[model samples]
Target: MTLLSWSVIEYSAKYDAAGELGHVRDTIKWGADYLLKTFNSTADTIDALVAQVGSAATAPGSTQPDDQYCWMRPEEIDYPRPVIECQSCPDLAAEMAAALAAASIVFKDNRAYSRELLHGATTVWNFASDRAGNSSYLHRVIDSNLARQAGAFSAGKDHGVFSWDNKLPGAQLLMSRLWLFLSPGYPYEDMLRTFQSQTSIIMCSYLPVFKSFNRTKGGLIQLNHGMPQPLQYVANAAFLASVYSDYLEAADTPGWNCGPDFYSVEVLRSFAMTQIKYILGKNPLKMSYVVGYGQNYPKHVHHRGASIPKKGGDRGCTGGWHWRDSKEPNPNVIAGAMVAGPDRHDGFKDVRKNRNYTEATLAGNAGLVAALVALSGDEHGLDKNTMFSAVPSMFPSPPPPPAPWKP
Candidate 1:
């Protein structure tokens, strides 16, 4: 949700041009309202928040199938789905604060609703701060460990990926941007600067000139070897890299330095563009990772909602499972859905059961939307290099999936 909010905040002009600004805001508000509802707050303090909405199973040791094991639609979820609450969860609280804060900025025109969002952000931020106790937040920990030396900022490294499971890299960049709005010595000023410098390091790491990231033979960044899911990380890396380029342009800094080497903003933006183009069907398989984008995109997306038909009768949990193993293409098309993408060797399987390559995630699509918007309708000074030749006139059979990548 935080990523989704940032997507709008980063590309408001594009959304406005598309006549979808209000729709985007309403979408964000829906997520923000749910976030606010997760908090158990009174006045200025939060007692606890719902950390999780669904459990792994029905009971502690029961073998009964429940939410996690079931594949039924949302309306058919009648199982014992419990909400897990937590008190000292700084990560969750802080992410919620960030989301609400960004959404507040989006709704700033509506003073009343904006104030409500700002109040929620403030309350959640305070909760995160109070629960962290000075030892948990990234900046404070870096300060404690490095004694606020220049090396303290430079020591941090970014894997060039961000998602629901990790918010540290995203938080650092956001806080770094927030630092520009603060007065010197305004309590967390130094902390923000530390984050700012670390953001620089993060951006530096993604630049191809730095040679920090490993790219596949077909030019896709090989970070996680495409295990579990790959496109989400690629999409996130592209989004953040593009955002940092925009940050440089906004700050009028011209470029960034990765140690001895200096990379222009154009280079950074071009790297982001290369990533976007790769997903849109420029890879080894000449396959678009996003569904419903090009003719050669995935037809067997590993999603129940996409694979199953929307008939009158309710297809209970067991019925849904039958659809999961079907060999046919999905009955429904999830347009603009970014799937898990190819392996490190640029190999992809369009099998319905292959979650690693066919599954689409909200996080992946959020990043994709942000990147697409950031680079939309503009192609000034982009790298036009291709990793492989055009698809053969006479198509050949695809090679088997490569062995698991080793460092």
Candidate 2:
């Protein structure tokens, strides 16, 4: 969640929307710091760290709700958080990779901080890339018999990330693409070539064409494209399209382009815009999955923080927090959040219990911010050579070919 939040805040700040750049910097620092802390604090020997923290599951048919039923702050939990740490999950590592790499660019002026982020990103990417595939430890964790016994998939069905196994390649591709855009020279050049190869394979399997499997009266909401798919898949593709568009926007200037196959930047931008609009409100559902986007947006978003209202005065922190599952509307709004999107047939039910349609997630937000950065358009005032644009100049200058072998 912190990673996703940072992705949005960083892009918004870079685009000058998450308040002023200075204030947004501080906010983004909090997230980056936490991710760094989480990775650094771990004593495990793995080169990568997990991106999630959650309690162990209850037995199937368990009548009692999880800790969330208590309706208390996370600090108030009776015990230390029980979590399954994927010390080397490639998907999680890839996400962290993208987050840190992006953060490094955002904080490029702070050389030390940017280097720290870069170092972390580079390490995680290396670990994830080395451990990519079906037999990886991450696949074991998500596709375990223990999880099946506990009905985790049944629960996750409400959240739309049902088949997490297939997402790693996409995450890896995006992370590699982003890293390639920001890096130059030596090991990075080698890394970029490796990424381009992986991207070719991934693109062929997931999104070979610029266009979607969308029909005239149907699209992602219909889920008519494939089996057990997550909205994030399409969303990730759109974000990649936007990334390509960003490259094109910098084509003549930033010195970045994927290949000769991609020339019509507007086509990519248009596809991105189409997905963004569908997410915002233009789907057959005619409802905005994001909070506060449209008149008919989802009210009962499945988020803990947004369900609670601000407490002050007599209503202090000690009190005023409880489960209030009423139709009175959430007293607080999780603004700028993107929920799990509509079902097939563009059907949607705005219910907190229907987490598949209402839950907000890190992957969802990461994709959202990427699209938002593009949709918000470029901040013309900022220096053009800041992030990806600055990459070409960072390459190591040759040593004049050893002075023409002056032996």
Candidate 3:
């Protein structure tokens, strides 16, 4: 059962990524077949169990004498008998129930999938509603539908799931682009408020440690000694913040520096770039000040101890590298930039180059650095190049001159 469930999820992702209408159709068909098969097999077992339960009732000295017991009814029996019972009849019923639920979900998902395949944005939005009446397992489907419908109303354009309000800041940028394509007259203020709400939760609550650390460098965000320390929470929190720009505002808070070492920083940056085109409009070139204390240096002290040169079998910076060794970048940088406009070419260029560098020489580090650069621009100070260089439109230009001496 687990394998089957995973298969459907995996295939769905693959089909969505394929971006080909025909491929999506075929993938949905295959998924439907699997679901139907599982359902039928479960149903057959249920039928056989009902027959056995009836036979048992008829046997001599059985506790169940006549049809007097309400539980005697086949439908009333525990669908998937409890472990204590271990009776085949109950087990069969349980399996059947699960299979039916899965089938129902697959049906709705297929409808949305089909509508997307046809490039019918309106159809997809209409199908996204919870009209199917299966709330327990279909809440995600409903949410997804609501988001997509909202996006359709905003943007005149249509794409598969890509044209939906994802409740995440980074995701919103992508949806906004589609909305623009469709030319829908959406309420920008309402959208911004929604993003702000999600960001506040992620920054203040989810990653309080990171927030604390952002306020005080020596605080919890830096402590890695104890279990469930602020570092892990910060990692996760930063990840959430990066995807949602509301958290990006948190970056403006003092003491926190965006860089590759911060795990969440990089993750968030990647999400933002994929959805948005550029970071906030402040061009990196406009800022003459560059602080080197946090740039390009490792953020976490623990990482310094973990570092080993390539020849010594050390991981050798294989993971993502940040702008500052210690400070983590905000994730929404990418998405923000993408949505803002193409003028931020320098920032995008920096991301592409840095991403390539990390990809070839230090694969893991590249992702981290790329995400950070995308988020905070060059301000975190990993390299001396102007933050302006990281914008998407700044391509074809040579790397910016090294930073001038600090002092």
Order of all candidates by TM-score, from best down to worst? 1, 2, 3
Off by over 4 Å in 2: 1-14, 17-24, 39-56, 63-65, 68-76, 83-98, 115-216, 221-231, 252-263, 308-325, 378-407
lDDT of 3 by residue, 1-407 (tens): 21122123223333233353244344445643443332223221222222222222445555543332112223223323321222234323433333333333333446654332222212111223212223232223225455555452242212111101222333343233222222223333344344333333333332333332222211223212122212222222233334234223333322122332233544444434432221122233221011122223111221222222223332222222321132433221211111111111222222221321111112122122223332443323221112112123312568889989897
Name the candidate that leads on TM-score.
1
Q: Model 3: how far is 231 from its true place, Å? A: 13
97-142: candidate 1 lDDT, tens digit per residue: 8788778777767888878887887788788877423234444533
RMSD of each: 15.7, 8.8, 23.5
TM-score of model 1 (CA atoms): 0.81
Q: Could you give candidate 2's per-residue lDDT for residues 1-407 as a string of tens digits?
A: 33333344335445565455565467567777877775652322245365556544367654333454334444444534555556557667766666677778777778998888877766666676673333342233333363345343232322222123344334444435455445544444654555455444333322325332433354552222543224555566666655544543453433223345533556656666777788888887788878898888988877655665555213323242443344546667878778887765567777765677788876566667656665564542223344344334445566665445554
Q: Which residue pairs of candidate 1 clash?
A: none
Clash number for candidate 1: 0
Tell me the lDDT of candidate 3: 0.29
Q: Give the TM-score of candidate 2.
A: 0.64
- lDDT against true structure, model 2: 0.54
Error of 1 at 81 (Å): 1.4
Worst 10-residue lDDT window, candidate 2: 155-164
